[model samples]
Target: MSHRIVSKFGYYSLAGFAGSALVQLAVIWPQTWIAVVALGAIALLYFAFLLICIKGVLKGARWAGVLNFNVLGVDAIESTGIVLFFVVGGVWTCLQIL
Candidate 1:
């Protein structure tokens, strides 16, 4: 409903999407045509949802607030997965550099 809420949602959604993508890529270790295609499809759908949320937020739709809240809840559940992914990936990257 409010612009502040919309902006917060947009920021969180973008962050969540990035985190999810990273985790997906790490888990799948894409190495084949099917894997690439599937990842691409998943990316497309993810972006679509993000776009819808953005549009709804910009338009100040009440439904957007509801959707944003739901997304936040989902993100919270995925937070653990994202955190683990980040921790492992960060350590791996650091070790490689060292």
Candidate 2:
């Protein structure tokens, strides 16, 4: 039951992220068509995996929940790394100036 809930949330979040990205790309239009194309390709691949997981969940595959947890875990790690990088960088700069 929890797996189904998480899977549904993942689907909606991924869709929302992709939609917002497209809107942003449209706003920038001509300047970054190359980037838009690259991101679009990557987004398609990401969506494919999510769809596969969705299918697995619907079919009662145990691995689907594991895959979803792994994906979300990696995302959490990546975000934390980014935040730490900036925080440490700023602190290092301040210490150097002192």
Backbone N/Cα/C clashes per model: 0, 0
lDDT tens digits, residue span 1-98, model 2: 67986775565555445545544554557565565456556555656665676688777787876763543465744543343443344334334443
Per-residue lDDT for 1-98 in model 1, tens only? 78987775565555545545544554556444355356446655665676677688788898897763444465644643344443444345434443
TM-scores, each model vs. reference? 0.39, 0.37
| lDDT: worst 10-residue window of model 2 | 82-91
Q: Against the true structure, what is every candidate's RMSD?
A: 10.8, 15.1
TM match of model 2 to true structure: 0.37
Question: Which regions of candidate 1 fall more than 4 Å away from where they truly are?
Answer: 1-31, 69-98
Model 2, 87: alpha-carbon shift in Å? 32
- Candidate 2 C-alpha error for residue 14, in Å: 15
